[model samples]
Structure formats: C-alpha cells, structure tokens
Target: MIEATNTDLNSPKTESQSGLASLDPRSKILLACGFILTLSLLPPGEFLIYGLLLIVLYISASLSDCSPVYLVRRSVIALPFAFAAVTLLFTIPGESLLTLPILGIDISVEGAIRFASIVTRSWISVQAAILLIILTKVADLMWGLQGLHTPAILVSVAGFTYRYLDVLRSEASRLRTARQARSATLSAGRGGGTLLWRARVTGWMVGSLMIRSMERSERIYNAMLARGYTGEVKTLTRFELRSRDYWSMLVAALTAVIIILVAHFL
Candidate 1:
C-alpha cells in the first residue's frame, strides 16, 4: 500500500513550475488531451500550424519553469516510433523521389511529407504529455482522473504502477550488486569460463530474482491486508474549480478549436 511522490522535492525551480503547478489537475489534463487530439486531426505538412502549436508548447514549458532542453530530450522518446511510421514511405503511393538499389524500394514525395507530419505530430503530442506530467503531482493526477469518471481500474493500475516501480527497480539493483560481488572475475576460470555455463548462470539469476519479487509482493499484500487495507485509495487533495480554472479551460478549448480550423484550412 505504498503511495507515490510524483514531484521532486529537491528539484530546483522552473518558470512554469509555479504557474502550471497551481492550476487544477483536471483542467490541465483535459486541456492537454484536448490539444493533443485536435492537433492530431490537423493536416500533415502544415508547418505554419505546427509552428504555432510549438510556440504555445514552448511558452507553456517556460511558464512551468521547466528547462526547454530537458523537455525536448524527453519528447524524443516518441521519436523512435518515427522509424515505424517511415515504412509509409514505401507502402504509400506517390511520385517516386528515389529508389534504393539493393531493396528496390521507391521513396515517394507524398510519403516524405506524410512521414514528416507523423514525426512532428508525435513530437508535439509527447511534449504536451510531458508538460502535463511536469506540472501535475502523481496523486493529484489520479484524484483528478477519478473525478473525471475515468475507469476505476485504470486509475488503480496507474496508482500501483507508480508506487511499485521504484521498489522493483531497487530490488533489481540490489540483486545485481550481490551477484557481481559474489561472482568476481578474479575466479573467472572455474565458474565463468564457458559462455554456455555463464548464460545458464544468468538464467538462474533471473529465475531467482523473479522468485524474490513474487515473495516480496505476497508479503507486502499480506501486510496490507493485516492493516485493514481495502481496495480503495483515499486522497487529501480537493478539486475546487475557481474562476481561473474555468477561464483557463475556455482559453484552452478555444485555442484548440482555432488551431484545428487553421490546420483544416491549411
């Protein structure tokens, strides 16, 4: 029954940290989602619209007092999917720009535009998500989702995943440290000479780690039950929407709609 601390207590101040952190979590979530969904519908290759959106996003990041470099780096996590989207370069029909010799693949100009659009949209969407996370506390976010009538199971899963992810990581680190300590390369001749034997040992280590994880989970669950833990999560954050929340929501909705319209026009 561990709870999660989403924000860094020791992290230095950012520009938007104060402003974005003060807004209602529900408002932020809705606005971010709205922006992402609307932006997704935007026509590809509309650089003007994407530029406007990027400006808005960069401003939001700045207000949140978050580092622009950090946000850009974090958003790049979605870029790997660009490789998958690039396959459209071949499967899609368009004027051929060039062809590879060995694979005989024809690259199309239309496909190139579409691929750029895909990558741009993904980068923007990921940045939006990262901004939301940077400004919202994990517990407050879960509470907001519950208020929004999100599926209870999904909320519960998110809560537990956030809570236990660090625990699992710590356990894995300890296991790795112990293994390395016990199997020093100084005696590599006897126990770690053969590659096959080394692989078997690695497999055994993984099995042992899984067993430990299961035992730890069972123990934690039993302990929670003994303490009268139910399946319900209670939080102290209150969802009181003031004039600011409504105003922000209105501005965000209008901005999204306008952007969507502009995208369509472009």
Candidate 2:
C-alpha cells in the first residue's frame, strides 16, 4: 500500500550512466541475476568469497555512477537483522576460541568468522540489488522478471505499484507541508499542545490519503475499462537477449560450480 516518493522514484532515473547503457537490457538483467545467484549460493562461512563479492559490487557501483558511500549507508539499514543471525552462531556449541570470564561467555572463532562472512555477503548482495534497481527502470525490470517466469499476477501488481507510488508519495508530502504550515500559524507562541496536535493531524492525513488513493484507483479502473482493456496488461517490448547474455549466464554457472566444489573439498 505504501507508494514511492517522486524523488525516490525519479532521482535514480536521472543518474549519469557509466557506459552500461550500451549493453542491452536483457544482458544487464542476466549479469545482475548471475552475480546475485552465484554469490548468494556460495558458502557464507568463507570470508574470502564474501570479500571478493563486496569488492566486485563496489567496483560495479562505481562504474555505474553510484556513490559508494550512499549505497553502503542505505545497505546498512538491513545489517541489524544480519547481525542478529550472526549472534546465534556464537551461542551454538562449537569449538571455543576464547572465553570471557567477566561476561561468562565462550566465543567460537569459527562462529565469529561465519558471522562476519554472512554479514559481508548479505551487504554485498543487497548492494547488487540496489545497483540493479538504480541502473534499470522499474518497467524494464518488471518486463525482465516476466520474461524470467515471474507469475503474471505478481508482475501486474508490481507494475501498478510502481506507477502509483509517486502519486501517493506526492500527496503524502503535500499533506505534511500543509500540516506544518497550520502548526506554525496556530502554535506560534504555544508549545505544550504541539505534539498532540501533530499526532492527530498525522492520523487524519493518513486517512484522507487512503481515501483519495482509493478514489484514484476506481477512476483508473474505469478509464481502463473505457479503453477496452482486458485482463491482460500490454507493455511495449524493449529487450532482446544477445550473445553477451549467454556469456554472462555461462560465467554465473561456472562460478556456482566452482563455489560448490570449493566448499565441498576445501
């Protein structure tokens, strides 16, 4: 139900390309999928692979004109969950590397290593996904997902959500601005009742936004019906897989095999 803000949806679209524009959309999608799958399936206990993937992602982001600091900052929001999972590794019985008598806890070196590895791998994987979103438009990505066998219903929902998110976000922002202006005028000298008033205003704003969104949805459906839209959503085709896509797929397969083999024997 949450919609994307206009700035959130449009800022990435205006990003300066770093030569990736030459590659067809299919090739880019293949490369992105290949990298994500290969890295994710690799053993998370190994720091070397995770580190390598992080470096690869950083380089990729840099080449695509994505700010490394911004990507890392945004990616860290999910780090807490990763860290919580990592904490469990220390609790499970394993070879103890150190015992902290004051804390009454035994730390396993293997557990600590695995924890770091998983966090790093997760961060890198998220960065890859964020980069893909930044580089490709939502419509193009949805089409690519459809070609890759994502269910039609889910794809339709994703397309609709993307299209309406900006509209909803704009409405929310405008309401927020109006509330701030009213507060400034009504509470210029008073401070005690500001918080309560703001909370009430926010609740009302949310309710109004929902009602407006529902009305807009009805209008959109009616417009579609007037245009003779059937159950299917028609979209312009813009992608074709080239030799590069095959090459990327082969590299991904090889990487997966190699990682599995390494995890098994080494």
Candidate 3:
C-alpha cells in the first residue's frame, strides 16, 4: 500500500496559522452546508440576499488567509456547469424579455432572473466548499466526516479517492514523459503525427494507463488487506470541538437564519 505523504496528511503552514482554519473541521463542514442550504432556500431573484451572502463568504475567506481574487477565480469553475440552467431562460413563465434570433425562443424575464439566481447560488456554494478544502487537510477532513457520523463506507471511499488522485496524477505524468520521449517532432517543431494518428495514440495511452492503474490497484488492495485495512479510515489525531467551534457554529447558524428570514420577510 502507498504511504500517505505529509502533503496528503498535514495541513499547510498558512492554514495552521489562520484563525478560521484552526477551527474543528466539523464546524467548518456544518457552516458550509448551512450556507449552501440557506442559499438554496432563498426565492429566485433574491440578488440582494445573494450579494450579502457573497460578502459573508469573502469575509470568511479573509479570515482564513485566502485571497479574495483567488477564491473568485476558483469559484468561476461552477459557471460552466451553471449553463445547464440556461433552459430556464425560456422555460419559466413570465413576460418575454427578448426573442432569440436563431432559435426564435422568447426568453422570459422571470426565467432569466431564476437562471441568474441559480448561477449565483452555485458559484457561492462552490466557493464555500473550496474554502473548506483549502483550510483542512484530506486526513483531517476524513476524520471530521467520521466524527460527524458520516457513513463509514462513504468516508472510506472519499479518503481513498483523495489519496489516490495524486497517485493517478503521478502515473499520468510518467506516461506523458514516456510519450514525449518516444514522440517525434517535425521540422517546424510541431508533433510529427497527423490528427487521426495523434488521436489514436492518445486513446492507446489512456487505455494503457487504465490497465496499469487497475493492476496496480489490485496489488495495492491485496497489500492493504494484509495490513488490515477494513474500510475504516483511522487517524492519530482526535477531533474534539472546543468553545470556539461551538461559537463559530452558533454564529454561522444565526447568520444563515437571519439571511433566510430577511429573504422571506424583507
């Protein structure tokens, strides 16, 4: 079995020194879930509420020693996925905003508002999750999940997935190195292969990687079984909630409640 590296098991110096990062992972997890849930509950077109929540997110980012620009850049990853909500631009019933020139579809004002809300909600939620990931090490995260009564099997799977992503990445790197060593370049310094040939080679590389990964995984599993890994992730550090943890949770819960209440009442 592969040994966990410090990079995998240990929190970074920045996280260790940050105030918010010092909180128990359980508290962070709960706060993120509550924030996302609150965002989901807000009615469509609650742009003011969304903007306020974004301010809260940025404040948390600053508390954790993360850059607001970096957080925003990472959060933009959700936008492409948010495009799935585009159909809502025509599906929701309301006054027509404009007719599409090509599709001849009339975009409803309500649908546009709903789509914007969905995109904003998704972007904010992803940033919240990214903050959690940035602050906690994988081992600590897994331990926190276990402590929070997350199912053993799911926690185990998550732990393995996080650990082996680096393994898979290393294997891919090796494959790329080997490919480059073998690949020829043309006089113009471009790759020698035609488009189709390059595609075929890429497919072959993928297949080879999959086969090798499967074989290695089988050996790793057998070795793990010999070492008594029974689908339970164990950590040396025990997670106990402190006063700060409770206080943080309380503040987050109250903030979420207030946001929800304001969204509804105001």
Candidate 4:
C-alpha cells in the first residue's frame, strides 16, 4: 500500500552504505552498463550464461549494501507484463500443454520453452537496472551518460527533470494534505466530483506548480551566476579505475566471451 510518491530518491538505504560507495562512480557505471548490454544482446537460451550473470549481479548488489528483498520486490513488478506477453506462447499451435479445437491454434513445446526463457531474461534485466540505480547516484548517472557521449541537451533535460520531479511531488503532497483537511467533514461517497470540475482542479494545480518551479529555477540560476557559473559542471573528485576495477571488468568480459563462444558451438 506504499504510495509511489512517498519513495524518496535521496534517502540512502542501509544497502547504499556498502562497499559500492567506496568504488569510483566510473567503475560502477562501466560494470553495470557492460553487464546490462551483454545480457540484452546475448541469446536468451543460454541458461548457463544467464545464471552466471545473475549471480554476479547478486554479489555486486550484496557488496553495495542493497537489500535482496528490496531488489526482488522492485524487479518483480515487471513480471506480470512479461507473463501476459508470454502467456500467448502457450496458446499457439504446436506441441503445447494442450490442443484447442475452438481456434485452430496449436501450442508447441518450443513456444513454451521460449516463453520461459523470455521471462527469465526479463527478470534478470530488470534486476540489473534496479541494481544500477542502487549503486550509482542520479548525478553520477548523468555524468556517466555524458562521458558515454550522450547529447548535452538530453543530459540537461534529464538533470532538470530529476531535480524538478521532487519539487513537484512535494508540492502535490502538500496540496493533497490541504485538500483532505478542508474536506474532512465530507462523506466519502459524496466526495465524487464532475469530470469538468476535476479537470479544472488538476489544471489549476499544474499551473501553480509550474509557476513555483519556474521561480525556483530563476533563483537557482541567480545563485549559480553569483558563484561564477560556467556551462560545464566540474566534479571535485576525478574518477580513476583501480586494479580491482580492471579485475572486475576482465572477469565480466571473460564471462561474456565464454557465453558467446558456448552459444556459437552449442
């Protein structure tokens, strides 16, 4: 029953305080991106390789102080959608669970296997993404994207969007509380409103939030200007890959290469 709006991006859980914080952001980014790319590009039928990758991710998440429960909970949210798409595979005509006469559709064993493979791959991929967010700060993610040659405008947009989302959310929460307080005496059944009235209220809320955000942006710009702001953001700490970083990268690369070779041979 936890509302999504109550999720705080800035609050670091106990898992965030693990060894991951000690590693350079660059290393975390490289490892995460490399693993994700390999998983996505590799054949989903390579169960061995997928299993190894999942283990690696679990270890990394553990070292980072991320709770396995939290990771699993967040990752499982996508399972329903994946399940829906794969469910159709069981209904296709072939050697499936059962043959149906109503719709000349045949379900095959291959389809069921493929469906299972897709589900496993989807689960692993989602977990990888969640781990990435857990290990790397949002600012570091933006910086990493920049380093990877992402467009400046796109990076700027992402940065601004992340910053403003919290502001807007806070405003919305405050408004909701105020509304609840004012309507405390109203019966729940009578609280329903006309579509037009609801639309008008939503529009007003959006307009007010927009104005507040703009004003806040102006103030931020002025503060930056006073501090001799430049177009480039400079980081206080320079990222240097240590021996462990190279070792980690080497291990991941070797695993990927082995998987590719096995897939080709088998």
For candidate 4, the TM-score is 0.79
Candidate 3 lDDT at 42 equals: 93
Pull out the clashing pairs in model 3: none
Instruction: Tell me the spans in candidate 4 whose CA falls farther than 4 Å from its real position.
Output: 1-7, 10-22, 90-93, 99-107, 181-191
Name the TM-score of candidate 3.
0.80
> Which segments of candidate 2 are over 4 A away from where they belong?
1-7, 13-27, 59-70, 95-102, 181-203, 225-231
Per-model TM-score on C-alpha atoms = 0.81, 0.76, 0.80, 0.79
Q: Count the backbone clashes (under 3 Å) in each candidate.
A: 8, 0, 0, 10
Encode model 4's per-residue lDDT on 1-266: one tens digit a residue.
12447455764544354666556666777776777777777764677778887887788778777766677878766767885766557654556565658986666776776677778878888887787777777787788777768898798778878977877787777876665556433455444467686677668777887888889889988987899877656655456667877777788789877777776677
Query: How far does residue 210 in candidate 3 sit from its true spot (Å)?
Result: 3.3
- Per lDDT, the best of the predicted structures is 3
- Clashes in candidate 3: how many? 0
**Residue-level lDDT tens digits of model 1 in 180-237:** 6676465444554477967887788788878987898789789879988798766688
Candidate 3: where is the Cα deviation over 4 Å? 1-13, 177-203, 218-233
Top-down TM-score ranking: 1, 3, 4, 2
**Candidate 1 TM-score versus the reference:** 0.81
Clash total of candidate 4: 10
Lowest lDDT block of 10, candidate 1: 1-10
lDDT of each: 0.79, 0.73, 0.82, 0.72
Model 1 clash pairs?
A: 14-65, 15-63, 15-65, 16-63, 16-64, 16-65, 17-64, 17-65
